[model samples]
Structures are given as C-alpha cells and as structure tokens.
Target: MTGSSRRDFLRDSAVIGAASLLAPATMVASTTSDGAPDVPGATAATTGLTPHPGPLHEVAQDEAYWKKVADQYRVTNAVTNLEAGYWGLMSQPVLAKYHEHIDRMNRENSYFARREFPALWRSARERVAQFVGAKPSEIALSRGATEALQALISQYNKVGAGDTVMYADLDYNAMQWAMNGLAKSVGAKVATLDIPEPATHANILEAYTRALDANPRTKLLLLTHCNNKTGLLLPVKDVATLARSRGVDVVVDAAHSFGQIPLSMDALGADFVGINLHKWIGAPVGAGAMYIREGRLDAIDLAHADESAPPTRIDSRLHTGTVNFATMMTIPDAIDFQQSIGIPQKGARLRFLRDRWVKAVRDVPGVDVLTPDDADLAGAITSFRLHGRGTSQANAAIARTLLEEFGLFTFQRNGIAKGDCVRVTPTLYNTPADADKLASAIKTIAARG
Candidate 1:
C-alpha cells in the first residue's frame, strides 16, 4: 500500500501498531485536529472507590458499582471471554488518548519523532517509574515484558562456565527458553524444578528451598511474580531473600503481576525486573518497561554494545530501533487510568471474579482446580484439568468443547508438572454472571464424562 493509504487504513482501525505513518524529514507539518475528547467523567474521584460506600472487599461484591466500571470498555457479548491473560483491552479513555497521539505523530512525522519525542519519551518513562516506585534512571522502555526479559537474561554477565541457572515449570514459556539459551551460551548448567501441585505458602517455599539447596553452584535464578500458565503468584520477596543468602542473583518477570496485583519494585525484593504496560495497566499494545536497580547496571551489559545512551543510563541496557511512538506517549494516560481505579481495588475485584467460578467446581468429582483459593496465592487467572486430562490433545479438545458447546472461551496451557490445564482469566469487563456461566458449563461437561 502507498504510504498515504497505509496511514489512512491504520487510522480507521480499532487497534493501531507502529507502521510507516510518518512522512520524510523534510515534509512540511500538516495541521490536523486531535481525534476525540477523552472518556467522560474518567477522573480519579469517580473511578475506583470514591462512589462506593464500603471497603474494597465489600465493593468487590457490589455488582452495580462494578457494572459501571465495566461500561468503560467496549467488549463484545458474542462470547463470554475469559482469556484476558493474553493482553488487556485498552479502556475508552486510554484508547482516545492513543488515537490522539497517533494523529499528532502522523501529521508531524519525523519532525515530531526526532525533535519532540525525546523529552516526551523521558517523561513517559518517569511516569512508569513513579507508578512502580522506582527511579527513572532504573526504568527502560521495551516492546513488552518478553523483550525486556530476553535481553536481561541473554546479556546477563554474572553466569560462568560451571555455574547453574534455574527456573520452575510454571514460569512463562518464552522466559524458560531464554534461561536455557543463556545457560547454553555461557556453558552453564540449567536446573529445572516443578512448582508443587496444590501450591500453598509453605509447600511452595519448601520446593524452592529444596531446589536451591540441591543446586549449590547456581549463580542466577529466574522468578515469575505471577505464573502465566497457572496464574500462581510466587512469594518473590521470600525466595529472593533465600537466593541472596546463597549468592544467587534474581531476575523477575513481573509481566502479569505489576498491574494485576498491588506490586512495586520494593515489594518484589529483586534488583532486576521486567514489567508489562499493556497487560493489566491497560496501555496500548507494544508497551512495556524494564527495571535495573541503581548501581547494578554493570551486571547487565549494554544492548548490542549500543552507545546511543551513556553506559550509566538504563536505556543502554537494550536497543529497540524503532517502536510505536504513539504507544509510548500514551503510557501516562494508561497509568492514570489504572491509578484512578487503584491497583489494590482492581486486584480484589479480579480475585472475586476468579473465585466465583472456582468455588463452584472445586470439589466436583472430575475437576482439578490448579490455582489456590488463597487471595494471596492467585488472581484472575486460574486453570483446571478434567478427569486427569492433561495431554496437549485432551486439553485442546476440552477448550474446543467449551467454546463450541457452551459459547465460553478459555485457553489451554501446558508446562506444569502434574498436567496441562485450561486457563480462565476474567477482566474488568467480565461480571459475576459470566463467571457463573463458566461454572455451569464446566459442571455439565464434567458430568457427561
């Protein structure tokens, strides 16, 4: 497509990515109106708890209040979607801001990107740093959590030939792959372990402790604050403390945990971490950040030996040549929307939706719920295996059956030691009714077997 045609096509679409929407550097800037006004009454005072009467736990059960929050998203009722773990739908307010940035970027082209974007980029990074309780010098923007993490793992300079690197079965698949590749490149050994079935505070800690004790030569350990496959929230602070005593440095993948839960760099107790802006914070696609604690930059080598920024700055850690400029600019709007609703309150509601279905089928004869009911252990994402059905094909059939027979959508996940499971993740757009529908569908399917 011609450049003008491509820009027009992107402008009409609901979700826009980084394409050639800009003109040549010498092109004169065109004056265009910013697309639309922000979402009405989307201020902090009206979003999260200001209008609710009781505390957060009580507010979670308040269906009327939640319905209002749900209206902010343009979700379809064609199917009861429970696969929000993949990525989040940008709220109307954030979406509007995104479109506005898109128009401005397209109109001004390279002129805006070259001269104006640097300051705006720094400001956006600062906002993310402030929201996550880290310093601006410690945060660097990336395409997503996976990009940031892969760079951190591959470029990590501490591992030696005889050392060991380790991860668990429940960790993200891409991250696990990165660990393996890192070990291979450095001639280091890879140690893999399983997160205990029926995971709880005590048993989970014991499993990690046992693995660490068994592998004394371990130098770098990877931790996922929230497991993507099972939504198992790890006790990172405790595990990081344990690893530190053994001289093992920890790198955390907080992709799903940062905005889904009440999280901060301080709470995680890990100096190196990667987070996603698009997942729970509701930013546009192609937005994420990495954190490297002050004085720890030397441990993570510069990306591709990039000298674009000084070695002391966090931006030197990775190089993403060209990115969605508009997406980066909308970071503050997404952060604002999330903060207006409050992370603690959002997490409580998500857990409430998760519990709504899990509680109903937990004791059923053929069903096995993988995530614990402990609010501290899991959030919106939960997975289950039916009648010990965990093979790739069996779980795929289960997921297909749910979609075809019950009009419910869920995803099948594999990697846990016990077996494969179908993951159900509810977001702000989902309601109590959707969770109940899922419960009924699962009960019927399990009964027929």
Candidate 2:
C-alpha cells in the first residue's frame, strides 16, 4: 500500500465513529441538498429526555426525569442490578440499531467485510479516539480492553536487561499477565506493590512515590486509572508526571473509566492506554480501544502489520483476528447514546448513585466501604467487605447472600491483594430506589452478623 492508499484507508475508516447519524453536539453541519436545517437535536431517541440545556452537572440532579430515561433499556424485574462495572447493556433504541446492523452484516457478508468493514472499524476507532481528544492514527480497535492491554504491555520495548517494570496489585488481572510476560521479553525486572487499604488521595500518591523511589531502575510503569477489583480511581496524571520525572514511561489501563468518569487523553497524561467502550460507553460486548500518543508510538511494537498501516499507526499494533463485523458496526449507536445523554451528566449520575449507597451503609458496624472519600479518588464504582472479610470465597458468599436474600445482583471482586470484596456499580439506568434496595440488602446482611 502506497502513501495515497494509506490516506484513503484512514479517510474511509474515520467516518464510522459517529456517535449518532442524526446530529452532533460538537460539530457544525452544513445544510442538506433540500436546504434542511443542519442543527443537532436535543432529545434522546430512546429515552425522549431532552438533556436540559445548562451545566451538565445540574442536569444530572434531575432524578425524576432520569428515571424515565432508565425506561429506555429492556431491563428486567428479576433483580436490582448493581454490577454495571462490567458490560453496560444496550438501551432498547441502541439495541434496535444494533440488530439492524447485524441483519445488514448477515445480508452483505463478504461484500461488506471486503469493501465496508475496514472503514467501519476505522470509524469506530476514530470515534473512540475523538472522545478522548486523540487522533485517528493513534487509536486501534480491539475485542475489549484486555486485548488492547496485552498488545501495549507485551510490545513495550524500552525496558532492557536489569531495567524494572512496575505495576500495582489493583491492575486488571489480564494486564498483570501481560506485564509479567514483558519481564521475559524485555529482560526487565518486575516490581509489584499494593494500594493502601482505606486509601486517600494523598496516601495513594505516597504509595506510588515509595514504589518509584524503592525501584530506582524502573523504566516502565503500569497504572490503572480505575481498577476493576476495588473500583478505586488512582490519580493517574499526578502519578504519570511522577513517573516522567523519574524517566519512566507509563502505560495506563483505563478499562473502567472513560464513560463513567469525565476525562480526555490530556487529562490522564498517559502516553499509552487501553479503554473499554463496552463498559461505560455502552457499546456492544466486544468493543474497546487502544491509544498510543503520537511521539510514543515507537515505544511498543505492533502485534500485527498492515502493509497499508504504518508502524506509527496505532491500529497496526492490534492484530485482531477476523473481526466481528456486526459488533464493530454497531459501536456508533453506543457512542451516539452516550453523547445524547451528555458525558458530564453520565459521570455525575454514576457518582451520585455510588455515594447514595455507600453512605447508606458506611457507618454500619461490620460493614466496610473501600472507596475513598475524595471525589477524584472514587466514582460510581465502590466495593465493600463485611467484617473486613477478604477471601475469595467469603466475598463470593456475600454476593450470593445479596442475591438469594435480597434479590440484588452484584459482583464478587476477588483479585485485590489486600482482600476480597463485593463491587457495586450503578449506571445511568439505575435509580436511587435501586441504590436504596442495595443498601437495605447490605443492612439486612450486617444486622444478621
């Protein structure tokens, strides 16, 4: 592939990232051939709630209206779901669009895969990159954050014999595997540490300071912007700057942050990162992205090559096998749904839900909430252990009790080095009533103890 072919591939692929085909919140549009007005609409197609025109945080406070918004999903009456930290189920409107894309894929098959799928995949990549203030050339599509993480961590080349690579116990388990593998590939030493229990913003930074200071030869650091196990939000920008000053390159795992928290590439200050669109962006199960800052591309090798995609191109690093054409094509609907709701509002709603539940049971004897008080150090995702029980079986049993006794579907997060706990994450769809029910379940369990 020549330079023109590369440009064509990029140009064609860039169009698929549309959050919605209806209109855009950020882009100015030109009139159609029929002279129709090109302004964006305020109303969400699924929920019918026109996001109130004002500061996003203020709009987030209107719960009466947000309840109506939750009605947009084909949710169940089975249980009050508090496990939204994983895949964010699609809204009915988005699901309808997704089904349509699936039908189109089935109908078109090879024709679409050959001529249209690559561009759609690129579009999905571009939209994800745009949401984070990145360039199309710097983004790659993946099945989920795990694959993106493996590519970035495994391919990291700056570390050499005796140089150290550092990561915390809270980092995603799959990424931990990649970092451990990196030790063999680059002949680098692995330095692992733990986040202090009952972590505060200052204490979290202090922990990183000690780790970097103790490992003077550490050249690569793996930072989890938000960890899956505890849902603890680390001060990545501060830590990344700290690492930079120590001459260490940082790779971030933001698998749980992008849509649940307000951020951009510049906000986190990481040169390389892997993000999950499926988690908070509400894309389908297999959608996620990887980002490599332009100047830092050479720090990691491509997992696979595109004769057409240059080494500097981020997508070149993602040697994703035969792509899921249907799943990739429907990503725009998720992006559109997120944009319709407003990112700031989505973040505020999640944090609001988290606080409501954690506050409800925080002071209860024998109940412990693991999230920090500082807003920056926590968000919608929070975890807790009963009687400080940290074993995998203990946490799993607690989750089972929540379900069997109280009809609450929550998660048992078992990977924290400090201990195990149950993670409860509330999304835009969850109501305050849902939070109250979860709190009541915790109280009931604690009262028995």
Which number leads on lDDT?
Answer: 1
Worst 10 residues of 2 by lDDT: 35-44
Per-residue CA lDDT of candidate 2, range 1-449, in tens? 34344344444454344343333344332333332222223213434445556666666678776765676665677888889887898766566667777888899976766566666666676677778899987788788889888888888888899999999989888888898898987678899999999898788899999999999999889999999888899999999999999999999999998888779999999999998988888878998888899888888886654544566566567777666777877777787778777777888788888888889998999999988868888888899999878899988999999899888999988778779889998887788888999998899888877
Tens-digit lDDT string for candidate 1 (1-449):
23333233222232323332121232222211331224432332223423354687997888877766776677776888999999999876667668888988999997776556666777788788999999988998899999999999999999989999999998889999999999999899999899988999889889999999999999999999998899999999999999999999999999998889888899999989999999999899999999999998988999887656667777778787777889988888788777767788888899999998999999999999999988788988999999998899999999999999898999999988988999999999899998999999999989988
Clashes of each: 0, 4
List lDDT for all candidates, in order.
0.84, 0.80
Candidate 2 clashing pairs?
Answer: 16-123, 17-123, 19-336, 390-420
Instruction: Supply the global lDDT for candidate 2.
Output: 0.80
TM-score of 1: 0.90
Worst 10 residues of 1 by lDDT: 23-32
